[model samples]
Target: MLISALLVLHVIVAIVIIVAVLLQQGQGANAGAAFGAGSSGTVFGARGAASFLSRLTAVLAAVFMLNSTALAWIAARDVGEPGSLLERIEPVPQLQEELVPEDEEDENERDEDELDLPPPDSH
Candidate 1:
């Protein structure tokens, strides 16, 4: 529940940041000043809208980082359990031995025998 809530908040902040950035004007907007088009002056004051947008972008970015970390931690915790991939299937003790048959004596002897090979010739 906590994770879901945080995810929602993270998405909201991301959308807000994207919209705010798109609405803001670019640096070269002052090129119109040469033609006396001065529309930039009316949209935002002399200092410009950088301060407000920068602060908002910083806040939203911080929240995005924090929520990403939290989600990763939650995912890591959930994978740390010790169990088989098919844990939902019921265990049958009687079938265990049948699943893996015991090795015969001849097979064991073959496994114990070592192979003899000629030594490598050195130049």
Candidate 2:
């Protein structure tokens, strides 16, 4: 339960960080300022979004790192092991027997049956 919740949180934080990084303007955005375009029609004007988005990305990254450490610890500890993987699987003696018959007579009989097939009639 705890692991599942942490995993969900980790994914959400990752997505949010990606969005935040994308939303922040790059250095090339300043080219528009040379033409007096300014930072109008933008969500947080020129400089405001940069700081806010960077802070959000930073916090989300910290959360992601902590969650990753927790998940790694859980895997290392091997919790909730009702049984080992090999022990949980049931033996398949019947399948093995069907796949490989024990008697030499069975193989000979099968070969004979295949050879006894009627020849196809040509049109």
Candidate 3:
């Protein structure tokens, strides 16, 4: 359960990192401002958005790595346990084999049949 929760959180953080990276303007974006693209008077000031997004991306990436490590450790730890998902559940009654009586085929005949060899000649 803990590992599952961590996996979900890891995925969310990874998505946030992707979005954060996409939101940040590239270095070349500033070059457009120099030619009158109007980079001034922005929402997060001149440099605030870049720094904040970069920091957020870094923190989330670290979380993603830590979560991945934790998940790997948990999976490895569970490997030695006796019961996995299938073992925990009881099998349906209908799937079980039923005992049936067979006709009296002697031991020697059973053995010869099992060996699948031809019978010996009676010289």
Worst 10 residues of 2 by lDDT: 41-50
Of 2 and 3, the candidate ahead on TM-score is 3
Which parts of model 3 are misplaced by more than 4 Å? 33-50, 81-123
lDDT of 2 at 58: 92
Per-residue alpha-carbon lDDT of candidate 2 for residues 1-123, written as tens digits (9 for 90 to 100):
988998899899889989999997775656665565775544334544447778888998999999999999988798676778998788886643445545645544565557877889998
What's model 3's TM-score? 0.51
Tens-digit per-residue lDDT, 1-123, candidate 3? 897799889889888988999998776666655556766655333665448888898888888898899999998888865767888788777866765556654546565347867779999
* Cα deviation of 9, candidate 2, in Å: 0.5
lDDT of 2 at 48: 45
* Model 2 local distance difference test score: 0.77
The global Cα lDDT (0 to 1) of model 3 is 0.77
What lDDT is obtained when candidate 1 is compared to the true structure? Answer: 0.73
The TM-score ranking, best first, is: 1, 3, 2
Q: Cα deviation in Å at residue 79, candidate 2? A: 6.6
Q: CA lDDT of each candidate?
A: 0.73, 0.77, 0.77
Per-candidate TM-scores read 0.52, 0.50, 0.51
